[model samples]
Target: MESMNESNLTALAAFNHNEALTKIPTFLFLVLLTPFGIIGNAGVIYVYGCRLKKTNLQHFITLLAVFDIVCCLVAFPLKMVELWLPVMYPSGNLCKVQNSIICFTCVASALTLLIISVDRYKKVCRPTQSQMTLCHAKILFSVITVISLIYSVTAAFIYDRRSIPLDSDGYLVGYTCVMDFNSVVTQGYFLALFVVLVIVLGTMLVLYCLVWKEAKKHFMQSDLRYRHSENQEDGEDHTSPHKRNLHRTNRTVVLISLLFAISFVPSLLVSVLFAQFTHVQFSMTTRTIRELIYGTWALNSSMNPLVYGFCNENFRTEFQNLRIPFGCYGRYPAPKKNDIKSIAQV
Candidate 1:
């Protein structure tokens, strides 16, 4: 009996050793990514919201950065806490709050991207129609905030701390945050979330396709006009500045949406599997995989600034201007009036 008890102790120790190993990499990655996300998103807010002339596109970008910052500031830390002490944390309320806020930020980000797509579609595909105004944009942003809050509340109610068996012998069980997969309501909730994601993605894809078709036709016309005027002596550029700005804005939003889709879909899929398959028991390996998947989603929030820097000239220029306070302010000049006018036209 003593020898059997000793063997159980040895196995439990091994289980813990493996569990820690699995979580460490994800934990460290989040720890490193969090500060960069916070600082980068903050810079985005500063430059677009304050430094640049206020345009609708700038407003959308600023708000999106705000949502991303919440993910980095609130969600990432909660996730790191879960990873660092998965077994010892006992507050169900804290778990619920953590998961709920994470859901809110994610839903808000997705909806913002959808709105950007619609804006692009209207400008490019239906140029003669009435376009979205600043007042309308504000109203829509308020609506998005309310809807995200209401949708995310469900997560707070669904999740709770439960015992996750850590050893095959069932000698060690770790208390972790999760929902009961056996519950019909939980399965339905996940299914609904998945449906929403698919619909949002599908709608964006269709809208972008139509916008691209129209843009191609318009650009071809512009190219022909440019070629026709090339031999003239006036030396005026035939391309419309407003149209050029709109195209650049479209490309930037598309890149951001792609990043979100790539990171978010896999995390949501893993979650749906957990809810749909009741027999899907938690193991250290599976937990590690889930954490890594979530890390990708968190990484998405950090990455948008990089996308902005790469794709948008205005954003890139302002980002350089940010370095000026350290005795380099004279190196980069403020955006010209014509640049601001072009953005305003979009």
Candidate 2:
């Protein structure tokens, strides 16, 4: 029994050594993802921060995008370093800091999405209820801020570097700021947090479904009323504007739903898998799969800009105009005197 245990430990060490050496491909892949993520997420922040006036929904999404960008910036570059220079890298303290930031930002993003869903639910399902006021938005923001700070500090302290015996080799292996999953406190905390995240995400999904159903029902009824009104006017153009606006709103909602799913689902799945399968050893085969999962999660940072540009008419117009050169802008027709006068009258 002693011999078998020694052999197993020897094999695991060899596996880790081999895995550490072959990280070039992973590094190069991250090099590709990082720039796109930075550019796209920055664009999202600019759009929400500069163009849109401050509102509860916009505030939540703007901050969420900011957190996503911060997480990618803090975590992905270190991940590349860990991949490329696994041996020479001194991640003793950096790992703890980066991991904590990642965790906090990820939790903040999830909470923001939950808030957005609840807001939509109230707006659609219970429209009679008062809209979320500025005070309410501020309180929610403060709560998220406090929770994220507490989580980051706690995780950073708990996940310090440790030295453990390796096999019977009489030598110690030093782990640098990686979570000690075997520790009782670590396991318990993770289990509880995982359950909370699952419940929050599940609630968001259910609420979104309810919002969609309610929106559909209300839209159909509104369409019917508009059609009846038009019919009373001998099928004239009374309903055209209403129908156009409804179509635009529906399109926006569908796009937002798709973006949310694309951005979040991969990370959520990876988290659940990690929680459930604690004993799954990291191997060459699993390395690529793990990188892919992280890469997919990183893509969310890029997807936000695309979603905004495609779904929001105002954003699309702004993006197009911003892309044009000054010379090109000069070539466009200026407003006529009568048009300026009419605008002033309005």
Candidate 3:
């Protein structure tokens, strides 16, 4: 089994050797992406963690943001190092640790997003019967923590280097540490993780679609009610006080749904594609296409802030009032008293 795995890996390495270089561009883009991710996710953490009233949903979302931040921090730096330094510069243990951190954080982020979607669906579609209490939030947190730890440990144990070639010649290449993805345990772990991610994400997507439809139906009913009231007012000399409020709420729901779809769907699609296609021995053109698709996933992190600002009025106002640090390009207002309080809480 070990010999067969080594042969497969050798073939894969040879196959990938002639592909287009990815290190430089990917690194440069990651460097540009890191600050955006940090700022956007940090703001989300702040809003949900400190500014908003304490609730299970809010806490879960805050933790999701934190998970995203961790993902960016862990994965981006290692990616940069891999791009610039020699691929074998890192020791075996360091590589294992880095890979495990990346895997753990990325999985945690995905699971947390799933949790957020489910939480939102419940609150929006089944508010009265929703079981999302503080205790539920605690349980969710514990579950995610346990899952992340287990994933990290498994990854660490499963990743290692057995041998390296001495040179570019067919005879031998220099020894370098690399993950043994050919191992049954490693492959099986990845396959299981991908399966779980797909199932959870797909379920959440379905729930969100149902929630959206129901919300839209409720919005239409509210609209009809307002129109009826307006017609009666035209006939009887009366005005409807709740008409504007209903419209505002409807707009809010639509905007939030739109933001979620736009910011999240691309990343989900990329993840699915990568899971299915990464191991395929594609032509250069196809490989390029894959890279492009994967690159768009970074947009998800960058656009998160824009989505939040557009969907949430509070975030918009707070962002506009954010005080820029010295030497920054953009104008920003001083922090509000509430912002100060939130910061203090943090």
- Assess each prediction's global lDDT (C-alpha) against the native: 0.77, 0.63, 0.59
Ranking of candidates on TM-score, top first? 1, 2, 3
Candidate 3 overall lDDT versus native: 0.59
* Candidate 1 accuracy as lDDT: 0.77
Candidate 1 vs candidate 2: the TM-score winner is: 1
Candidate 2's TM-score reads 0.74
**TM-score to native of every candidate shown:** 0.84, 0.74, 0.69
For residues 1-346, write the lDDT of model 2, one tens digit per residue: 8887787657655745665655555567678878766766766666555445566666776787788788668778877765653433465688678767766875676677677778777877898988888689889988998888777776786665555444469453534345666677776666666675677668877887887788677777676787786675554554444445444544544465455556556755675467567655677667667655655555555566666666555556555544323342344553354443221110
User: What value does the lDDT take at residue 48 in candidate 1?
Assistant: 76
Best prediction by lDDT: 1
**Model 3, span 1-346: residue lDDT tens:** 8887788657645533433254445556778888988888877776566555676656765776676687577766765554444323455676677667766765665666677667767756786884677888888888988898788888888765445543466554333334565578877777677676667667766876776677666666666676686676445533233433333333433343344445345544665455555456567565555555444545544555555665456676665555443433135444566654333221
Model 2, which residues run further than 4 Å from truth? 1-26, 161-177, 225-283, 323-346
Better of 1 and 2 by lDDT: 1
Per-candidate RMSD, Å: 4.6, 7.4, 8.0
Q: Number of clashing residue pairs in every model?
A: 0, 0, 7
lDDT of 1 by residue, 1-346 (tens): 8987778657655665666677887899988889889988988887777666776677888998998898888878888777766665568987888888877877888888898899889988887999999998899899989988977888887888887777667766667777777787677777777787787889899999898788878887775566576754456565655457657777888888899898789888877666556566578777778768766777678888988887766666666657524332245565677765543432
